[model samples]
Target: MSEFRDSGTFQGERMPKRPNIVWFLAIGATLTGVAMPMGTPAIAVSAITSHPNQKSDPPSDRIAAAMRAYLRDLAAKEQFTGTALVVRRGEVLVRAAAGAADAEEDIPNRPDTVFRIASVTKQFTSMLVLKLRDRGLLGLEDRVCPYLIPGYIRTCPQAWRPITIREILTHTSGIPDIQQLPGFYIKLSQPTTTRELIQRFVNKPLDFKPGTSWKYSNSGYILAGAIIQAVTRKPYGTVLHEEITGPLSLRHTGYSRRNPPAGYAKGYFTVGSPAPPINGSQAFSATGIYANADDIVRWDRSFGAHTVAPPATVKQAFTPQAPCPSNGCLNLPSSAYAFGWLVDRLHGHRLRYHPGLLQGYAASNMYLPDDDIAVVVLSNVEETDTNGIARHLATMALKSASAHDH
Candidate 1:
């Protein structure tokens, strides 16, 4: 812990208004294209291979300067805090950080600074489930209750019996969101087991009949985590490493259950003001993962290189499973939901993305398959619109690449 500073530009017009806790913590996405399982050796290389005839990114100096200055502007206005990484055709365009990771200690943000990834964890959790499915250990349509790990000595609620793994993965299972439950804040403040957390919300009636409607539910993913544990007989974190991160050599990414790991960013509400605290375990499989910008970029590349799964299988996860109506879903209006991503078109190009929010942290991960561009923005400031930042950067990158092609 470090001393909190009271005096700064955060006191001026630069300070952001606190966002509604419910909406801010909603951490959510959609998309379809491919599905893959982890079995082959991970592609641990730093550079992704460019596709044949893939357009080159705009001149490095121009795009890099444009992105760097844009990030700096956001930081100067206290609008952003954390790191951003952009890659085009497997080449690095901009890897930059703005604001402080540990404001009290005056530690500046860096590309390698780790932050809790919140709902972005859903993708990893979904991947684990899909890999299990590929192994014939479980089916996407399997009832979640049957595979759930029996923690807290609790039985599956009658209501959950009809919930399938696919419904949960697509956020259409109708299991009420755990964050929206009574005493959710209090419950998350204390360290608890997944079963204990589930016990609190298990009895709640379904918001809608399974598969009939869409609602973002962390509880559904928690149940997904439980199923993973039951089937693999391994903890979620253990399986995450054994199957995904370890094989990919993504040393900086893993599940952190209670405290920020070494070199991790200290979350903030504003410059110098510490963010509220919550037990990481409360998020469990829904949002307990953490990673640096570099690791996320590497993870994205794995999908493109088919290092994580077969091409056809990889396409399964990215295919839209649930449609987002005109009102929009997550942060993007009218985007459809895929396994762990949101599917929409960015300037007519297929875009798969997700945004995550947790106490004192925000993250956006977007991949434009057509452009082969990956833009990740991770912020330690709560309520910061990292998704917006990431989208803006992605669009900018795409435009630059398009310009170069012409």
Candidate 2:
């Protein structure tokens, strides 16, 4: 529950003139391996900062080294305990892991270590909805209640009859967050069916009329999962694989398997103890997916190439749909909720990102679409500031690249 609230907001003041590496370090991971796939052409470093041709591209190794040192320091301090990957224009600039994935077992985190990505799952769920719309199977403006499968939800609450698919996607549906409900934590320990989870919030009155206000509610995504199930006549997980991960060949990204996969990172609390266990099904469409840095990089590429959906649909997913105040929902100043992603400006860059937290795991997936930079930080340590680290890395990447241009 803390993850949902803690993941997206960036608390640092405005960007400084240059990379304040030390200062950012105070704000924020390991040195692992760096890969530059063969035959991959070098991206113009100048383009990253939107500065036209000036000089030749700089070696990415320098930036990677800086990032490695930064992460190594964090891990030593027990601030970050997982993996971090930064990609610029399809090139892996930084791929590193710090701290332990399973401390008791002496397992170190790696670039391929899978962590429960929590609400980062929301973006994928939103993509699923967009794909459905692309196939003409549904419309974003369609009423949500009509699509609730009778087998699962006997009746849609009267108050829910007016909500729209678009509203849910944008977190403007006003359904109370499932975590806000009584005994939600206890419920996480128990295996619950999607319908059962829906029932917990279905009878509750709307926090506000759908689309009239904005709120971060897993209930909205839960309803989304139900709606997807209703229309596809397949389980949400099945549909997710068939539509997104399968198509992308995202080898390590999807709902948790009955048995944890190889490289699975065990989560932990900040106090160096094991975090409470959670039933993956309980998180469902909102926070159930697991993926490593490599898989996430590929997922990010799909967006840049417009391969997941038609270019128009992808554009809509990134476009601002609902205004969120700095102190409200996401605590991101001048931010707007765009489908499952949050949109904001960082030093004039078009930044699109989502953060996820569930018990011991925290994840931050950020993209500077304009600059073609993607930063993914996944940690098993609960409450870690992966978002701040991501923003700092992004700024550093841009600044470092720009320096080379000069």
Candidate 3:
């Protein structure tokens, strides 16, 4: 919300269209050699640590000038409109924002500006599910149907009856996304309950049989949220608060079922377009959270510092769980997925990440465990290349971090 650069702005070529992997893919890899839940080993697990005041993120002069200029160039073209941040270990290497929070009010984006994290919210949901698993309240491999008191109610042509929680996390459950279902917008025009949202698609048949295939499904997460509620006997939001946010003190993060919390960014399909309305009830644990760049970094660090779970389970979620097989998997190296994260290798380094998109928000939260770096990006403009920006900045930071190694 303050000045990025008042003297002059630099111009670089606009960000190119990388492969269109934005929201179409599942969660991905990180930690090339850290240990996760299943006895898998990733190398850099020893380096993941955080101090009590890891919030100090002074911009590092070590970051290349071109990287900073590139973000500025994208903003100058009205292509970028939110916050981007890079944290290596516990230090902030790059922190910047471009464009307005409310274009009508001419609010500038800032380091602390909140944005709808969209599907990145899934990572949190996944974490909550894992926490329950660790406590022996539920098993990850258990069938989801038994947890639902109302049962799996969907009208799709398939007579499928069983889908495991693991299958849901890996996008192999074959449940069709409730949002893409024919009458999603009508059913989602206003607030609704998790059970009500699931009811709308309860009778739908399976898009694909569970566990044999993979496809992104928001309804699968709705089912997951329902499972959480059924087990805890509390609302998903309440559980998220008690189990996750409250412990972490993530003051800026929430389930965001009604109006976006005070001081959050107003999303737009285009720069001059009016803000779009959201049905938070429809999103639930799948995509109903709002957060700032700083809180997101804290979330990342928590996972690294073993604040979330034992090392092995953390690695399991970050570990690549499914195959790419080009079934609409975005073109990437080893483009497999995991629990609410995409676990893949880019440039021979393990990367765990997820990209989220909503009506007017685009977000990507990525961690490169081999490099001990995490990138958090939130953009209000729907069309902005937030995922690309995160990828490019992480690549640049890795390069810089590599250069300093000598």
Every model: Cα RMSD to truth = 9.2, 9.5, 9.8
Candidate 3, residues 1-406, lDDT tens digits: the string is 1222211111211222211111100012222222111111212112323334434222334363456667767776777778776777555555566666766655555556678898898898888888889888899889777787554343422344577888887788887788787767665547777767877666777877788877778877887888888888888889988988787767677885786566577888887675566767777888888887767877787776777678987887787778766743444334787788877776778888888888888899988876778888898888887878888888887876766665
Ranking by lDDT: 1, 2, 3
Q: Which residue window of length 10 is worst by lDDT in model 1?
A: 20-29
On residues 60-105, what C-alpha lDDT tens digit does candidate 1 reach at each position? Answer: 4466567767776777678888878787776666665566766665
lDDT of 2 by residue, 155-180 (tens): 87788888899998888888899988
Please give the distance, in angstroms, between residue 298's alpha carbon in candidate 1 and its true position after superposition: 0.7
- The TM-score values for the models, in the order shown, are 0.84, 0.84, 0.82
Runs of candidate 3 exceeding 4 Å displacement? 1-64, 151-158, 186-189, 327-334
